[model samples]
Target chain A: MESILQSLISGIVVGSIYALIALGFVLIYKSTAVINFAQGELLMFGAYLCLTLVVVLQVPFWLAFLGTLIAAALLGFFLERLFLRPMIGEPAISIIMLTIGLASLMQGIIHMTWGSETRVYPAIFPVEPLRFGGMVVSQVYLYSVLFAVVCLILFNLFFRYSSSGIAMRAVANDQQAAQSMGISIKKIFAIAWAIAAVVAGVGGILIGNINGVNASLSSFGLKVFPAVILGGLDSIPGAILGGFIIGLLEALSGMYLDPLFEGGSKEVVPFVILVVVLMIKPYGLFGTEEIEKI
Target chain B: MAVKCGVFKTTYRDDEAIWQTKVSKFWLALLLIALLAFPFVFQGSRYLLYVVNSVFIAVIAAIGLNILTGFTGQISLGHGAFMGVGAYCSGYFMTTLGMPFLVCVVAAGCVTAIVGMIFGIPSLRLKGLYLAIATLAAQVILEFVFVRWRGVTGGSQGMLVPPASIGGLTFNSDFKFYFLALAFTILTVMIAKNIVRTKPGRAFMAIRDRYISAEIIGVPLFQYKLISFGISSFYAGVAGSLWGHYIGIITPEHFNVMISIQYLSMIIIGGLGSIHGTIMGAVFMTLLPEVLRVISGLFSGQYPVLVNIFGAIRESVFGLVIILFLIFEPDGLAARWKTIQNYWKLWPFSY
Candidate 1:
């Protein structure tokens, strides 16, 4: 019972980070209808920047975090403008490949700058583990979960209240109709990219806190896909829910299934869920079903 | 005398010929002769022979990718896993079952085709990027299996493949393998050409251009999607089998998302829906890293930072090349080649 409680706490913590990253995917997919394969890379970029500033340059964590967010927003805006803008009217596959190219470019850049070595992130918070009765949680995990929930709430408020947020929703609803109503789809695209990048940046910091920064972190971005797909690619709340569900699945699988399967079941479970979900509910639980005209 | 500048097709037979013009036939014969004689001509150059052999294998894989992504318009990111399936299957068959090289290669391809078809089932409901994601899931799951399935896959340490041999001759040397690779490459290309020109190929194009319309017009979407996957995976299987034998080992890492991306880039930069483009793309992609290495080596002596950053530079440049091609030449190298060919064919009066 204590182990299950511990697992639940850990799962929820990790799930929040996944949720943060999935929000990036949801934001981009909602605005442009293109899945940004580079969201993971973007997360890596944020983590590395934070690392370089806070640890290498010896800047304060909060200052480095702010710098990372700014950089991420700018990166998102420029990426959309430079690479994706040119591919405005291109086929779906081409656009998808462009994002992949961007991901590869980021990976290459990260490898060159940091080398292939994995580095443990500097401790910002106290190293003590937090406990409530029999259950225990690391300070880093607790802080990461708290940070993610706070960000999600703020983002929810932003989307519900901000003018640009409404504009983004309008464009996502129908680009032609949105344009007819005088909404600048280009501006909304840039905003979506920027917002997604910021979210990914926070996710990177949180993940880096737990596991350290490395190329595999980009794959962490990829692991969020099942979450995003489960939640519905375009639904913000869905992304969060998917993240928690996947997080629990991973934790439970690691605890229970790994012993029985002799390991490897934890990694495979999410994809198994992904395939099943894709087959049964491609649009996801919260996703808008696209009605195509022949 | 028949290999002239101008020609006219007088009958359906002449029009339907693989080489429509006598010049094309002569050139093809000459190229075939050149390929057959290449090993003998470059007997001293082991490096060039090795490069050509790898290029041939990559061409086969790229052609398979083209069939699925280019012709069928069903984007797949799990291509490398399919290749891995073929490699592991053939390696297992050759070592455990003691099968002959040719039979193992064909059997490997057949097994991969079945696997591909099963994965392609998702395409019945998903399209475009969603399908790509589904394929990505396939890649991740297969990769996990390759690492964890210790009994059959030999776990993460990987498995060794026996040298391909036939009739008292072993293709262990580059010279021998070049011929083997060339034979398979030629066979694969011929099959690709035939598929593209025939009815099923047409059905693939129709589905790609407009799936709903194609469905309405009586093309079975699910069947054709599976067929495309089957055919593509078959080519990937053959390539993977050849690769396993050539490299003498198989690992899950050997076929990963990176390999899938490289194959996709080949089709994208080589020219989607064009057989010739697959060859061109495969050659370009395979040689690109080598080209970067040479250039970096030249400069690394002068600038020591180049030595440390070469890997990153190469990777970034690869990504940049894909972006440039997507933005500017989405039709790929084949379209450019066509334009040049037309310019030469029309000469001074070129439009």
Candidate 2:
């Protein structure tokens, strides 16, 4: 029972980070209707940038964090303008390939700049473990969960009350209607990309704190697919829910199934669930179903 | 469609000829002769033979992927895993069952086709990105199995495959393997070219353009989609089996997500839905790294840093190339080839 509780708490901590990364996916997919396969790369790049700032250049942590977000946002905006803008009306496959190519490009750049070796982030959270009712939680896990929750709440308020956020949502709903209402679709796309990058940056920093930064960190973006798909590709709340579910699933599988399989079940379980989910509910838990007209 | 001024077709059979023009036939025959003479011409260079052999294998795999992604418009990201399935199957058959080389390749292809069909069942319900993600699941699952199933797959350490042999003849050297790869390449290419021009091929195109309309028009969506998956995986399996025998070592590492991406890029860069373009994409993709290697090798002596960073540079160049191609020439090299051909055909007289 204690072990199960431990797994559940840790799962939520991991799930929050997944939610943060999945937020980046939902953002671009919402506004631009293009799934950014490069989200993990963006997260990875952001983490590496922050790492370089702190470890290599010795900048203060908060300053470096802010710098990383700004740089990531600019990178996102630039990528959207240069690569995605031209592919606005192309086939779905082309857009998918474009994002995939973007992912490869970022991966190559990261590999070239940092090499493939894993690099540790200096501990920002207190190293002490927090105990509650026979369960031990790391300070970083607690802080990351807090950070994710705050970010989610802030985004929720932004979408509800902010004018730019409203405009972005309008574009996502109907591009033509939004354009007619004088919302710049191009600006929305850029903003979405930038915001997604910032979100990804935060997720990256969190994950990097927990697991360290490496080229493989880009694969975390791939993991977001199952989460985003489960929650519904276009639904933000669904992404969060899916992220939590997948996180819990992974943690539980690691604890229970790993010994049975002799290991590696955790990595494969989310995808197995993804396949099952796709077969049963292709639109996901909260995703809007697309209707086709003949 | 682009017939010469004087030539005219009198029957559907004449129009449906694979070589539509005398000029085309002549060029094909010349190309074949050149291919046959290639190994002899470069007999001294074992490296060149190795590269060409690998290109042939890539062409087969690329053509397989093109059948699914290009011709049928069903996106699959599990192609590398399918290839791995073929390799392991063939390796197991050869080592444990003591099967003949030709039989093992065919058996491997059949097995992969079934596996591919099983995964493709999701296509009945999913479309576009959803389908792509499903294939990604297949990739991860198959890769996991390849690593964990030690009894058959030898686990992550991988399996050793014996050199291919037919009676007294063994393809132990690159020279011997060259002919084997070449024969399979030509056979598979011809089969693919023919497949694209037939009824099923047209059905694939119809589905790709729009599945609802195709279904309304009496095309069986589920059946054809499964057929596409089957044929594509068969080709992948054959290619993988050949690759296993050629390399004499089959490992999970050879078939990774990156390889699947490479195959996708080949079809994209070569031009989707074009058999000739698939070949072009395969050759270009396979040779790009080799070309990069040669260039970097030349500069390595001058700057030692170039040696250390060559891999990184190649990866970046690969990504850059794909991005540039998607942005500038989305239709791919096949369309460009047509334009060039038309330009030359209408030269001097001009438009």
Candidate 3:
């Protein structure tokens, strides 16, 4: 019973980061209708950028975090202007391939800037474990959960009240209709990319708290696909919920099923769930069904 | 030279037409005969034969992938996994049950077809990026299986394939494997060409252009789409099996997402729908990385950062090439090259 509770707590901690990262992915997918295969790489860049500022430049951690977030947001905006803007009317194939190219481009840039060695990120939070009843949680993990939830709440408020946020939501619903209602689809696209990068930045810092920092963190982007798909593409809240669900499954599978299967099947469990879910529920948990015209 | 000018002039029926054109048939036939003879002429140098064998193998995979993505407008990003599926299946059957090599090939193709169908079921409803996601999930799942199922797949280390034989003679020599690969590729391409010209092929093309309109016109969505996946997977499976046997070993790494991307690039660079494009795309891309490697090695000493710039150069250049091709020459390197050749052929006369 204690072990399950520990698993549950640990799962939620990791899931919080996945949820944040997936939220970024969902935001971009919402406005553009293109899956940013580069989202993982973007998170890695943000974390690495923060590390560079904090460790190399001797900047304070909070300052580095702010700087990295802005830098990543700018990078996202730049990508929107240069690569994605051209892909607006192109076939679905081109948009996908472009993002893949962007992903590859980011990978190369990351490799060039920071050699692919794993780096130890300095922990900002207290090192002590917080014990409550029969369970104990690491301070950094708890901090990560708190930080991500706070960021998400702020984002929720921004979307609920801000003009740009409402416009972004309008574009996500129908680009043509949104434009007819006097919303600038182009600006919405840029804002979505910018917002996604900020979310990714937050996700990066939190993930660094838990997983440490490395180029391999870009792999989490691929893992986030299962989470987003499970959560439904159109629903932001679904992304958050799906992230925890996927994270819990990963933890559970890694513990209980990994031993039985014995060959690292747990890593693939999310995908199995994703394919099965997509096959059964093409619209996902909260996705609206799109009607196509001939 | 009493060539079949009657069949060449004005136009010819599909059955009566020469290989491409009247002038091309002779060149192609000579090319084929020369290709067949070159390995024998090389005094049995195995390495050259191996590369030749791979080119043919990649061709088979490319053609299969082309059918799905190009003809049916179904984007499959996990063909590498399907290829892996075929390879592992064939390798397992041959090594364990002592199945005959021919049977192993057939079984490999069949198993992958079944797996492709399983993957394709979701594809019936999904399109665009969603469909790509569905196929990618298959790739991920298969990669998991490859790493986990040590009993069946030999785990991450993968499995060793035995010398394949027809009846009794084993293909231990590279020349033999090359011949087998060449024969398989040619046969596969021939079959694919015939398929794309058929009524079902027309249906696939129709569906690709617009699915809803095609559906309204009485095209059966489930049947033709499944047919495309089935046939495409069969092609990928055959290619994978050939690749396994030819390489004399198989590993999970050989069929990663990058391999799938390479296949996609081949069709994109070669021209999406054209058979000529598929063949040229495969040949060009299969050789490109090697060519780039050798060429880059010449300059690496001058630029210490060359190694660092390698992935970047390859990626950005690859991307730029794709985008440029799409904008300037969307017909692809094959079709554009053909047009240039035709201009040269008609030099001195203004049409």
Candidate 4:
């Protein structure tokens, strides 16, 4: 029971970070209907950029974080304009390939810029563990969960009230309808990508703080698939819930089943869950079901 | 010889003929002669033979991938894993059961087809990216099994495959393996060509163009989709078996997501639905690294830094090439080849 509780807490902490990154996926997919296979690369680039700024340029940590967000947003907007714009009306497979190509491109650039070695981020948070009854949580994990919740709430309010957010949502709902209402689909696409990049940048910083930044950090993008698929690809709140669920699932399975298999069960669990979810609930828990027309 | 201005088909059989004209048949014979002559012509150059042999294997695998993704419009990311299944099966059969090389190759293909169809079950309910992700699950799961199933797969260290042998002759060198790879490449390409031009091939195109209408026209969606998967995986299996025998070893790392993506890029860059294009794509992708190597080698003597980041440069160049091709020539190299042929055919009296 005690071990289970400990696993659950760590799972939530990891899940919140997953949710934050998954949010980036939901954003682009919602507006453009294109799954950005390069989301993980974008996250990795953000972390590396922030690291370079703080460590090499001697910038303050807070300023480097802000700089990373701005740089990431610009990078997103630029990528959308250059690579994605020409592919607006192409086939789904082509778009998918394009994003994959983008992923390879970004990965190559990252490899060239920062050799393939892992680098630790400068400590930004307090190193103490917070106690709650029988359980203890690291301060960084608490900060990650807090940041995730704050971002989620802020995004929720933005979509609920802000004009730009509503416009973006409108475009996602119906491109023709939104166009008729004078909402520029192009602008919405760029904005969606930019915002997604900002979200990914924040997730990257948080994750980098916990685990050192490396090229493999981009794999977190793949992990986000289970979370988004579980929550529903297009649902923001669903991404959060799904993230927490997958995180908890990974933790619990790691604790109880790792010994039985002699290890590597945690990595496979989310994918197993993904397969199960795809087989049983492909549309996901909260995803809108698409209707095909003849 | 007289130059024929144009050729016309009078019946369905004439239109359906694989070679529409005598000229095409003559060219086909010429191409066959060239292929048969290649190994002997390059007998002094083992490296060249090795490259061509790998190209042959890649062509077989790419043809399989094209059958599924290009012809049927079903995008699969589990292709590399399916190839791994084929390799491991053949390796196991050859080592444990003492099976003959030909029998093991066929058996491996059949096994991979079954595994592929099993994973393709979700295609009944899923489409597009959803289906792609589902196949991704198959890839991950198969990879996991390849690592964990130590008794058969030999765990992460992989398995040693025996050299391929016929009744009297054993293929132990690149020179000997070249003929074997070439024979299988020709056989698979012929089979694939026939498959695409027949009834099932037409059904695959129909599904790819628009599945809803294809189903409305009485095409069995589930059966045809599974058939596509089966055929594709069978091709991958054959290719993988040949690859294992050629290398004389099998490892899970040989078949990974990167390889799957490479195959996908081949079909995309070559011409998705064209058999001729599939071969071209395979050749282009296989030779790309060698071309890069030659170029880098030329410059490496002048600047040592060229040697250091060669891998990074190759990767970026590959990504750049894909992006450029997608943007500029989405129809691929096959279409471009046709355009050039037409241009020359209509030269001097061009409209």
Candidate 5:
């Protein structure tokens, strides 16, 4: 029971990181309706940015963290204004391909700048374990979970109460209506991208704390796809909810299911659930039902 | 439009025809003759034959992607996974069951098609980003299965497929293999062309353009989407087998996610919804990296710095190419080619 609880704790910690990345993904998809395959590369860039600020520049932790967020947000806004803006009114496939291209572009640029090598991220949080009720939890893990909860609360408050957040929501709901209401759709897209980048920056730093920073760090973007699908593509709340669900399921499957079928049954479980969920829910748990004007 | 050419009055029907003008007929025939003589024309060079064989195999996959992202208007980033399905499934049959290579190839297509349908079903319900997310999940999960399912997929090491023999005629040579791939590609392209020109093709376009209106007009959205997936996967699967047996080796690395992206980019750059464009897209995209390598060789004059510099520049520029094309030539090279051809054809009298 203790081991299972410990697994659950670790799972939520990891899931929180996934949620952070998925937040960026959902934000982009909700507002722009583009998958932003570059989301992973952006996360990769965020982690690297933090690594550079802390290690290369020797900036303090808080300052470096804040700097990374600002830098990533700017990158997001730049991408939307430069690449996505021109592709407006074009076939949707063109936009998706643009993002995919942006992913490769960012990956190559990062490779050139960082040389595709794994770098040791400077420690911000303590790496000691804390004991509670016969369960030993790592400090970083607890911090990650707490950070996710805090971000979620802040995000909820921002989206629910803030005027800018409400405008973003309106843009997400109806692009035309939002435009007619004097909300600049283009500005909303840029803001949505900026917010996503900031979320991704935080997630990248946290995950870099948990895992080493490298090109593979971007793969976390790929990993978040399952979470987004499960929680719902357009659902901000679902991004947080689904990330935990997937992370816990993965941890449990890796532990318990691994013992079965010669211990490899767990690796494919996330996708199995994804396929099953897509087969049933389709729109996902928190996604809005698509309505046709026929 | 009416045109008078050598005592023949060519109408719009003639202009729209696949084979209308005598020059077109002659050119097409010459193309066929060249294709038939490709193996011998290569001077029996195994390396050249191998490269061409690989290109032909990739064209098969490009065709599949063209159908999905091109025609059906669904984007799939997990195309490599579908190809892997065909490869590993055929690998299992060939190794364990000792099935004939021919049977295994067809079976691979069937298996991949069903996998495509299964994956594609969600596409009927989701649009754009959500569907892409679903496909990405499929890629990761399928890759994990390939890596973890030791008994079936040979784990991460992957399984090998022996070269195929037909009625005691072995295709162990690269030239023979190239011809085999060419044969299949021609047949596949021919059928695909006809399929796209049919009612089913119209249905896919209608769904792509406007789903709700198409449904109101009695187009079965689910059935057509599933069929598109089935056909696309079938092509990808067969290509996998062609690739597997030609090399006499199959590994998980051979069908990674990047391959899917390569195929997607090919169709995107070639021009979606056009079968002929798929060929251009696949050939160019597949050769894009290789061409960079050659350019690297050209600049290696007394210093090796050019190679690495060119390599880095190539990757960086390659990424920008997508964005540039998306912004400027979203219809792709095929559309540009069409416009050029039309411009010349209608020169001196602007429409």
Candidate 6:
């Protein structure tokens, strides 16, 4: 019982980071209809930037965090303007390939800048774990969960009440309709990308705090694919929900199945679940049904 | 839209010829001669022969990917995993089953084809990026299997493959192996060329262009899609086996998502649905890193830090090249070749 509880607690904590990363994917996919395969790289870059400001340059953690968000936002806007804009009229595969190319480019840049070595983040959160009866949660994990919940609520409020957020939703719904209503679709694209980048930056800071900064952190982007797909590619709530589920699934599998397999099961179980979900519910649990009219 | 040139075809046979013009036939024959004479010409240099052999293997794999993603329009991100299936299967057959070299390679390709078809089943429901993501599952799952199935695969240590021999001729040396690879490369290219001109090839194009419309015209979606997958994986399998034999060892790391991306870039930069493009892309991508190495060597003498930057630059250049092609020349080198050919053919007069 204690082990199960521990796993669940850890899973939720990890899942929160996954949710944040998935939100980066969701925001881009929702507004621009382009899946930013580089979301993980964005997180990685953000972490590196934060590390540079805080560790290398000796800035305050909070100030460095803000700087990271700003830098990430600029990157998102610049990438959309330069690489993605020219690909507006291209085929879906071309656009997808563009994002993939961007991912590779970012990876190369990161590797060169950081020398492919993992760097431990300077301590930000307390080292102590919070105790509740027999359960203990790392301070970093608890803070990460709190950050995710706050982000989710903030995003919800923005989407529901803010004019810009509503405009983004409108563009996602129908580009022509949104344009006709005087909404700048291009501006919306830029804003969506910036927001997504900022979200990814936060996730990166949290993850880098936990796991250290490295080229491998970029793989977290790949891991988030299962989360985004499971929740629904175009749904925000689905991203969060899927992230938690995959996180829990991974933790449980690591605890129970890894010992039996001698390892590797935890890494593969989410993909298995992804395949199964794809087979049974192609659009996912909360995904909008795709209908084509000719 | 037809432009009249000095050359004319008098019969259907002439019109349908793979090399229609006399000049083209001469060039093709000359190229074949050159390939056959290459290893002997560069007898003192094993590295050149080895590089050419690697290019040949990559060409075969690139052509296979083009058939599926470029021709059939079904994007696959799990191509490297399929290659792994071939390499591992062939390795297993050679080491454990003690099968003959030729038999193991063919059997490996067949096994990979079946596995590929199973994965292709998901394509019947998924499309585009969704299908691409689903294929990622295949990549990850197969990678896990390759790592954990230690009893057969030898785990992370990998499995060693003995040099292939036919009758009494052992292809242990780089020069000897070059012939084997070149022969397979020629055969694979010819097969791919023929497939493009056949019924199934046309069906693949029809599906790629418009699946619903193709189905309306009686093209069976599932059958052709699976066939494309099977054929593509078969090529990857054969190429992979050759790679294993060439390296004399096989590991899961050799067939990762990065390799799949490399193959995809080959098709993208080479030109989708163009056989010539596959060859061009494969050779270009295969040689790029080596070229970068030489450049980096020059700069490393000046500043040691430049070495690391150069490495990153090479990778970034790869991404940048693909992006530039997608933006400026989406049709790739094949389209550019056609443009040049047209310019030469229509020379001395503005068409």
Clashes (backbone N, CA, C under 3 Å), per candidate, total 0, 0, 0, 0, 1, 0
Q: For residues A1-294, could you state the per-residue lDDT of candidate 2 as single tens digits?
A: 989989988889889989999998999999998978899999998899999999999999999999999999999899999999999988878888888888888888788889889999998889999999778889999989999999999999999999999999999999999999999999999999999999999999988999999988988889998899999999999999999999999999999999989999989999999998998989999999988887
The 10-residue segment of model 2 chain B with minimum total lDDT is B1-10
For residues B157-220, write the lDDT of model 5, one tens digit per residue. 7687788777688788887787788889998998888888789989989988888888889999
Which wins on TM-score, candidate 1 or candidate 6? 6
lDDT of 5 at B113: 95
lDDT of each residue in A1-294, candidate 4, tens digit only: 877888898899889989988888999999999988888988998889999999999999999999999999999999999999999999888888888888888888888888888999877888888888968888898898899899988998999999999998999999999999999999999999999888888888888988989988888888888899899999998898999999999999999888976677888889889989999999899999998876
Q: Which runs in model 5 stand beyond 4 Å of their true positions?
A: A261-267, B1-16, B36-41, B300-315, B347-351
Listing every candidate in turn, what is its Cα RMSD in Å to the true structure after a full C-alpha superposition? Answer: 1.8, 1.9, 2.9, 1.6, 2.9, 1.9
Worst 10 residues of 4 chain B by lDDT: B342-351
Summarize candidate 3's per-residue lDDT along A102-167 as a digit string, tens digits.
776677777778877787778678888999985888888888889989988988988889999898
In order, candidate lDDTs are 0.91, 0.92, 0.84, 0.90, 0.83, 0.90
| Residue B241 Cα positional deviation in candidate 1, in Å, after optimal superposition | 0.8
- Each prediction's TM-score against the native? 0.97, 0.98, 0.93, 0.97, 0.92, 0.98
Q: State the lDDT of candidate 6 residue by residue for B34-153, as single tens digits.
A: 998999999789988888889999999999999999999999888998999999999889888999999988999999999999999999989988988988899999999989999988
Q: With candidate 1 superimposed using the best TM-score fit, by how many Å does residue A181's alpha carbon deviate from the native?
A: 2.2
Candidate 6 residues lying further than 4 Å off, grouped into runs, are B1-7
lDDT of 2 at B24: 80
**What tens-digit string does per-residue lDDT give for candidate 6 at A1-294?**
988999998888889989999988988988888978888999999989999999889999999988998999999899989998898878777888888899989889888878888899877899988898978888988888898889888998999999998999999999999999999998999998899989999999988998999988988899898998999999999999999999999999999999988988988999999999999998887888798766
Candidate 1: lDDT over CA atoms?
A: 0.91
DockQ of 5: 0.52
lDDT of 1 by residue, A133-167 (tens): 75677899889999999999999988889988888
Higher DockQ: candidate 3 or 4? 4
Put down candidate 3 lDDT per residue, B46-120, tens digits, no spaces.
766766777898899999998999899999988999999999999999999999999999999999998998889
Worst ten in a row by lDDT for model 2 chain A: A104-113
